[model samples]
Target: MNTETSEIQGSCHCGTVRFQVRLSEGLMTARRCDCSYCRMRGAVVVTASLRDFDLISGEEALSLYQFNTHIAKHYFCSRCGIYTHHQRRSDPHQLGINASCLNGVSPFDFEEIPVNDGVNHPSDRVSRGGSEVVGVLRFVPSNR
Candidate 1:
């Protein structure tokens, strides 16, 4: 919880979904998950307690998607199909903010991001926070 206390604004691709999040430590918890769905979507995520996230607007324009165990509640913009944030399956107390959706921030600013083994989550398995290390990812900013 040792972080610069700041409120950051963010929106979806179509600008329909808007939100404000209070960062506990800016991007200190930024990371990527190696789960089946996460590996394909390829979004950098940051942690925020449930009290930290606020939907500024576009609740009606939002849609939800859940798969497999269905513990993690993933949200997106119905119009823009942009991933916003999700209730972490591993830690239900935190919402995993999509780092790509944060304003004035780039995922590439970090040289390295740790990957979580979401494929074998603690909820689904007996081991809590297993020692299985997936891999680290390097964010390369796109020209466009």
Candidate 2:
């Protein structure tokens, strides 16, 4: 991603939902989670403060889903069913923007993304520690 551009535009698959965000740490913060939901959804995410995220359109087309502790709120487009972003359960003040939803970006764009151990969430730890990145997800494109 371009470090020079802090703010970027995003939308769902069907374009029913659109938004703008200022990434907290550019694309360097991109990561994946090993939690059940994340494993299935399979989206690489980057961080952004809640105040830095702006929902430009499709308020009615947005649908939210939450489970388990329900601290994190996952959002997707109701029209196209594309996961857009989510409120971080570890830090409610921050939102995790699906990197693929960002314009001109794709999950495969990152070669190696740290995979967090959501199964052993830091908040649930005895000392309430920080994120535990278990491993890395790598994407190597073959010659076509």
Candidate 3:
């Protein structure tokens, strides 16, 4: 995780959705989740204050998806079918921006990303003991 802070531009796959956001802890907050939804979507997300995210364009092209508790609001491009960001269920004030959507950024950029145990989310637990790091996802590039 990196602490360098900077506002960056991002867009959906087909360029139907465009947005800019200031990462709260830069890439320091980057993480993956093992929840059912996250497991299927498979996006490396970084944290950002909802107030710091700006939807520059394609408002109508954005689609929302929520399930189960419906606290976390997942958003994506309706046209390109690419996820842009989501409002975190653990903290509504924060948005989880897909690192792949950011310009000049990719999920492969991180060699080792922490994976949260979303299957046993804190909200569902009696103690509400915060997120748990179940494991790490490492990407090793081939020399060939």
Candidate 4:
């Protein structure tokens, strides 16, 4: 899909953690994941290259969480307990930024978002040295 480069600023609730990220194509790639962890967190995310993400402040206020394969790194604010973003295992080159955190952006703005099948993450079935197919995300409309 074609995308336009956009720079967006964001922060955790209470502004304890601040950041700015340059998205390759704005929010055209916004989505949700269906893994158990994601289902509970219920965040809508968009991709950003690691180098494009800048933590402007509040490093001491940030906390981390990892699980399962431990490939992804989740970062949140200890002060407000808001999820800011995560280093994605599926795409090591990109991080998933919380869509709700972007300044003036709302999750309700998305008409529909794709849902990734993180529960059946391809790495589990594929050979260690080989790659597996991560099936396409389905178009799931929001009921709101």
Candidate 5:
């Protein structure tokens, strides 16, 4: 996370779904989950208000996948088949960006951040640090 305010760009693996996000320092929030799908995908979640994200291209080239609770609508590039961002089921007002999808941002940069387990849907367990663990669908401010 850059301390200075800067714009970060991201895209799917195939370069089809391109988007930009404006981030403040410490925007990469690490969320850990033991849930089957999240664990299997190894997702580190970071989020921004819907107003902060913009789809630059490949609208037609994108595909959406939803299942189970179906609250979160996962977006991926149809061409390369990469998960880009998702409309959060818990908070439809925000978009959860896969931190791995953003360019120039490394997961190592925010490794010190705490991880919240979404496994078994532990929606009520707060971490030792006192941050609220509302649900598996948590959002961190991009301009934190």
Candidate 6:
């Protein structure tokens, strides 16, 4: 496990879901998804093992929403109604932080990241949606 040396802070629009992550260069690896919600939100995700993320204040300020297999727990600020981060269903040990939520970090650094097919994950024993394996594409180039 990589030790975190710097801290990155983030909050929802309403200032309710305040949290911090111990940042490291390794954590900057971002990935996008073509799943319905992901595409709509234009989220680039950076994963941190649960130990790296801290919910400083606002445990009660947040609400949990789950769908489909109910393996992933999407956490949103109840006050501001912002989806800040989620406990990943694919990897139970990691927390998926929305790249957009990180202050001062550009998605450009994470360009050309591989997009995983959450909509048709093979581990999904029960199909909630149609299977469509989409090829990963560079959503944004570094120069752009």
What is the C-alpha lDDT profile of model 1 across 98-139, one tens digit per residue?
888888776776778889888777677775655255788875
TM-score of each: 0.87, 0.96, 0.96, 0.84, 0.73, 0.74
Tens digits of lDDT, candidate 5, 15-112: 88899986433364546555567667766767677788889988999899887788778888899877888887656777878777888765555535
Q: Model-by-model lDDT, in order?
A: 0.83, 0.92, 0.92, 0.83, 0.69, 0.70
Cα error, residue 109 of model 6, in Å, equals 5.4
* Per-residue lDDT of candidate 2, residues 28-135 (tens digit): 899999999999999999999999999999999999999999999999999889999999999999999999999999888888999999999888996868988899
Write the number of the candidate with greater TM-score, choosing between 1 and 6.
Answer: 1
lDDT of 4 by residue, 54-124 (tens): 99999999999999888999999999999999998887788999988988877877767777767777556
TM value for model 3:
0.96
Task: Give the C-alpha lDDT of model 5.
Answer: 0.69
Cα lDDT tens digits for candidate 6, 24-135: 3444456777766677767667777788898878889889888788888888888877778888777767787876677766555443666768676645646655334466
Output the TM-score of candidate 5: 0.73
Q: Of the candidates shown, which would achieve the greatest TM-score relative to the real structure? A: 2
Per-candidate RMSD vs. true structure?
3.3, 1.1, 1.5, 3.9, 7.3, 5.0
Off-target runs (Cα >4 Å) in candidate 1 are 1-5, 130-132, 140-144
Q: 2 or 6: which has the higher lDDT?
A: 2
Model 6 regions more than 4 Å off: 1-6, 23-27, 108-110, 125-144
Better-scoring candidate (TM-score), 3 or 5: 3
Which pairs in model 2 have colliding backbones? Answer: none
Record all residue pairs in model 4 with backbone atoms less than 3 Å apart, i.e. clashing: none
